[model samples]
Target: MAPALNVELAAEPRSAARSRRATTEWLASVCGYASSCDIGQDIVLAVNEAVSNGIEHAYADEDGVVTVCGRIEHTAPERRPDGAGPCGAFEVCIEVSDNGRWRPPAADPGHRGRGLMMAEAAVDHLALDKGESGTVVTLRRRLGCPVSAS
Candidate 1:
């Protein structure tokens, strides 16, 4: 993709769905894949969980902004020892961040503490960085086999 996608949203309940929609639409156009594909849907789900966590936990007592960014990176494929030519590949990176202090999850979260777990399970890679100012959740997925065309 030539231009990266970025969106800033108010930390609210509706922002989760908004972020999901934006990610789905942007990724579909950028990757030239159907939005309903497994990889695309998995990425969308991870993004939604991250954004929702930012809105619900990060800014639980204060108003803040959540940012979502998405981009595609071209990678040089691994060269086989058999002297096969290099094949192009791509990796998708999505980051969700909020300008609010991190809050520890409740002791008995019950049905609410699975966001991070679900996010981690959905993507090939997931990371969380919490600092003094805010928290950032990064999700990455490599486009491999079964990537169907749109």
Candidate 2:
């Protein structure tokens, strides 16, 4: 597969947009390489939402760092132990992490929240890890074919 895409940026409001653009470009490159752009768009939207949440909620007070990483995995179809058909397929994973504490979004209807919800709706799988140290959001989307040989 293509080398994992990585970016570290200041956890500022403006950085959210920058993160989105960088991720979009990387996804576009991967899609172009694979001749598949439809899925790339979905991945980009999900990643943007995750990054926005990191910048707005995770680092609400002081400056910190947000790390974005993208990777593609190609799994060859393999028979199941129960004599079932092959079950594995290709997938792309995107992770957006911030070295800042997590805070629940405001309850006000117009104040904040919704990024995670939007991200969840856009991706096949979504995972969230939160603790005193920081929060990490991972989004995964299944691909029809391998994007690269790696």
Assess each prediction's global lDDT (C-alpha) against the native: 0.83, 0.77
Query: In angstroms, how far off is 123's CA in candidate 2?
Result: 0.4
Q: Which stretches of candidate 1 lie over 4 Å from their true place?
A: 78-88, 145-150
Runs in model 2 lying further than 4 Å from the true structure: 33-36, 76-88
For residue 142, model 2's alpha carbon misses the true position, in angstroms, by 1.0
Reference-based TM-score, model 1: 0.85
RMSD of each: 3.8, 4.4
Estimated TM-score for each candidate? 0.85, 0.81
lDDT of 2 by residue, 18-137 (tens): 876787777656555633366766777888888877777776678888899988777666566686666446678888998898887667859457778888988889999998889989
Residue 42 displacement (Å), model 1:
0.1
Q: What is the lDDT of residue 24 in candidate 1?
A: 84
lDDT score for residue 56 of model 2: 74
The Cα error of candidate 2 at residue 17, in Å, is: 2.5
